[model samples]
Target chain A: MKELEDRIRQDGIVREGNVLKVDSFLNHKCDVALYDQMGAEWARLFEGKKVDKILTIESSGIGIACVAATHFHNAPVVFARKTESKNLDGEQYRTQIKSYTKGRTYEVIVAKRFLERGEHVIILDDFLAMGCALNGLLEICEEAGVVVEGIGIAIEKGFQPGGKSLRERGYQVESLAIVSGMNAETGEIDFA
Target chain B: MKELEDRIRQDGIVREGNVLKVDSFLNHKCDVALYDQMGAEWARLFEGKKVDKILTIESSGIGIACVAATHFHNAPVVFARKTESKNLDGEQYRTQIKSYTKGRTYEVIVAKRFLERGEHVIILDDFLAMGCALNGLLEICEEAGVVVEGIGIAIEKGFQPGGKSLRERGYQVESLAIVSGMNAETGEIDFA
Candidate 1:
């Protein structure tokens, strides 16, 4: 987490509207070395949970989730799709999730056959803000009757209430770096 | 490659309209173990070529790309963004990619800083048919002046012209499995 926070401080940019651009190493462009470390950290944090699978949304979450899945004994990864594709056939669990980054709500879905009942799943994502996406995953897990061991996130906006609210709800949410606040004008970031 | 072909035969389903659904272990629900083998295979195929980075489009390509990045000496992975986000502020290389599965076209963008000029990149994707996405990636690479060492794909519809065209164009393309033909009614596939 210290390494991640330092990397954020060194490379992350604070833009207008509280947007943090980590395109250099996190989201758009990725640092596999950093992701490997993060994966190891998640494996350590969620050790002994017997994670059967890793669930995450598409795009930003896929890379981190895949690397993290490698740490969990190479647990199989299943990513929820945010778009409707012709290849996505069969019965699926669908839910509406809001994306603060995209500024809209989209239908998120996962094939029903992928999530077996009584399986322990670890939900991972690149960033957590309003927790809508995380909540949507949790909702799908409940519908599938799977046990969510915990939630893992690379970065959390502490200024927002997603991490705090999830913790208050008794969810074991582990975030590598939490940005408490950011100043666009001064280009300063406060880490929690 | 044999393992991937076998796995595909075992789990891949052929649907109407020439759709080969391998969601059980390739796209929707991914088998990280299989992907690790794939990563190793790609490393073997592209041996001696220093792959500076692994470039992929988002959603389906991210997981495979990340896993593949680990095998390339932990080369940094950069995924093109499918949609505009608030955090994506900066100069970027943009291209329009047509998605057959999605039945639509989307603008793919990568930050200008990620792909350095003269750096060798291996573009990885989950599937290759018409090669629109692959071409978009090549376009971005050209715009960035990066040398595309090769293209790596998990599955290629050999019946389609994408892989054939790329190879004809003097680009080295390595695919794990090539589906020569599929019958939706009989539910059979012929691999090339």
Candidate 2:
């Protein structure tokens, strides 16, 4: 976790409107070593829990979740698709999520066959700000009748209420790096 | 590669409109063990190539490329963005690509800082049908002056022109499973 926090401090860019750009090592351009470490940390945190599958959302979370799935005994990763595609035709559990970064709301879906009833799953994603994305995944998991084991996040905006709300809802959320505060003008970030 | 072919035969769903759905273990739901094997296979095929980075597209390719990067000495994986987002700011290399699956044209962008001039990279993707996606990535690589060491594909429709055209272009394309023909009615698949 220290390594991730340090890397975020080193490469994470604070932008206006509380936007933290970590595309350098987190999202667009990925550091697989860091992703492996984050996966290890999550494995340690969720040691005793049963992780039948690792669920995530497309575009960003796919890489991190897939890499981290290696640490979880190579658990199968099921990423919820953020867009409707010709390839995605089947019975699916769907939910709508508002993207703070993309400035639009989109439907996220996972095929019904992917998430079976009574299966245990851990949801992982890159960032947790408003928790809109995670909430949508949770809704799908509930609909599929899968047990929510825990939530693993690479980074979380602690200044926002997303992390707190999920914790209060009794979900064990493990975030490698939590940004408590950030300043775009001075380019300073505080970790929680 | 045999394992991949066997898994495909077992789980791949052949639908109308030349769609081969292997989402059971390839794209939508990923088998990390299979992915690790793929990475090792690509490592074997593209061995001795100076791979500085692994480039891919978003959604499906991200997971495969990140898992494959571990075999490339944990090379950083950079995935091109298919949509504009607030998180994607600053200078970028952009290209227009037509999606046969989504039935739309979208702009793919990669940050200018991710692909440096003279850097050697291997482009990896989930599938190669018409090669529209790979061509867009190749265009970005050309504009960035990056050397494409090779292209690794998980599945290639050999009947399609993508693989033939790319091979004709003198690019080494290693497809784990190349489908020469498939029947939607009988669910028969032939591998080349």
Candidate 3:
């Protein structure tokens, strides 16, 4: 976690509206080495949880989730698709969540074949702010009758309520770096 | 490659309208172990190329690209995003390509900072049919003034012209599994 926080402090920048940009290593361009450490840390945190699969949303989450899959006994990484394609025609488990990053709302879907009944899963994401993506993934798991074992996140905005809300729901949530606050003008980041 | 072909033969389904669905293990639901092997194979193939980075488009490609990054000396993995986000406000290298699977065209953008001039990159993807995604990646690389070492594809529809076109253009394109044809009625697949 210290490594992540250090990397964020070194390369992450703050913008208006409390937006912290870590795309230099975290999102847009990924640092595989850092992701490996985060995956190992998550695996350590949920060692005995019997996580049958790793669930995440498409686009950004896929990178961390796939690398984390290797650490989770090569658990199959299943990412929920945000856009519908001709290939995704079948019975599906659906959940709607607002996109805090894009400032829009959209439904996240996963084909029912990927998630089976009674399977165990862990939700992984790049960032957990408002928890829209995480909640949507949890709802899909519930609809498919899958058991939610835990959640892992690379970064959590501590000033936001997403991580706190999940913890209150009795969900085992672990985040590597928690951002307490940020100064846009000074370009300083505070980690919790 | 034998392992990949065997897995494809076992789980891949031949759907209607020339669609071969390997969603069971390739795209939607991923087998990380197979991906690790692929990453290793790609590293071996592109060995000595000194690939500074690995590039791919978002969603499905992110999974394979991230895994492949581990084998590439932990080289940074940069995925071209399909949509614009608040974090991605900067000079960008853009390219337009049609999505064969989705029946659409969209601009793929990579932040100018992630890809610098003279960087060597290899493009990775889940599937190569019409080569739309690969071509888009090549265009982006050119825009950023980066050199594309080659292209690695998990599955290539040999019946299509994507692979041939790239090869004819003098690109080193390697595919783990090449499907020559399929029988929708019999649900049979032939590998090239």
Candidate 4:
């Protein structure tokens, strides 16, 4: 986590909308070494949990989730696909989510065969902002009667309500680096 | 490669329109252990190549690229973002690609900073069928002035023109499993 925080400070670009673009290491351009470290740390945190599978979303979450699965004894990773339109198939569990980054709503879908009843799933993602995407994943798990073992996030906007709301709900959520606050002018990042 | 071919035969669905859906292992629902093996194989194939980075597209390719990077000494992985419309930006290299699967053409964008001139880049992708996505990535490498060492494809549809055309052009293309033919009626897969 320290390494991640330091890397964010050194490479993260701050935009006007409280957006900390760690594209240098986190999102667009990925550091597999950093991802491996984070994955190992998540495995340590969820060591005792009976995690049957890892769930994440498409695009950004795939890399982190895939690497993190290695730490969990190579659990299968199931990414919920996002589509602008609804899927007519009744075979998939669907949930609508608002995109905090792109400022639109989309449906996140998972095939019914992927998640089943009584499975312990760990949800992983790159960024946790207002928690819309995570909520959508959780909704799919809930619909399938799967219990969420924990949530592992690479970076969390701590000033946002997502992390806080999950903790308040008694969910064990671990974020590699949590940005408590950001100064756009000074380019200084505060961590929690 | 034998394991991959076996997975394709067992779990891969032969859908209408010749779409071999390996959503169970390759794309949607990912098998992490299988991906680890894939990474090792890619590492073995690209042995001694000075690959500074692994380039791939968003969504499906990200997972494989990240895992594959581990075998390449933790080389960084950069994924191109797909957009419905092109954005005029001097700091990015963009390419237009037609997706036969998605039924539309989209623009894939990679920031100028991530891809450097003369960097040895290896393009990795899930499927090589028509080669639209792979060609788009290769174009980005060209615009960025990066040297493409080669392409590593998980599955190449040999019946299609993608692999044959790239091979004809003298590109060092390697496919883990090349499907020579597929029969939806008999549910049989022939690999070359």
Query: How much is A166 displaced in model 1, in angstroms?
Result: 1.0
Clashing pairs in 4: none
Model 3: runs farther than 4 Å from truth? A84-90, B84-90
Cα-based RMSD of candidate 4: 1.0
lDDT (tens digit, per residue) of candidate 1 on B93-160: 88889878768888988888888899999999999999999999999999999999899999999999
Name model 2 segments beyond 4 Å from true.
A85-90, B84-90
Candidate 4 C-alpha lDDT tens digits along B140-164: 8888899888899999999999999
Q: Which one wins on TM-score?
A: 4
Ranking 1 against 3 by TM-score, winner:
3
lDDT of 3 at A191: 89
DockQ of each: 0.85, 0.93, 0.90, 0.93
Cα lDDT computed for each candidate against the true fold: 0.90, 0.94, 0.89, 0.91
Report the alpha-carbon TM-score of model 4 versus the true structure: 0.98
| Chain B: TM-scores of all predictions | 0.96, 0.97, 0.95, 0.97
The regions of model 4 sitting more than 4 angstroms off are: none
Sort the predicted structures by lDDT, highest score first: 2, 4, 1, 3
True contacts kept of each: 0.93, 1.00, 0.93, 0.92
Q: Pick the candidate with the highest lDDT.
A: 2
- The numbered model that scores best in DockQ is 2
Q: Model 1 fnat?
A: 0.93
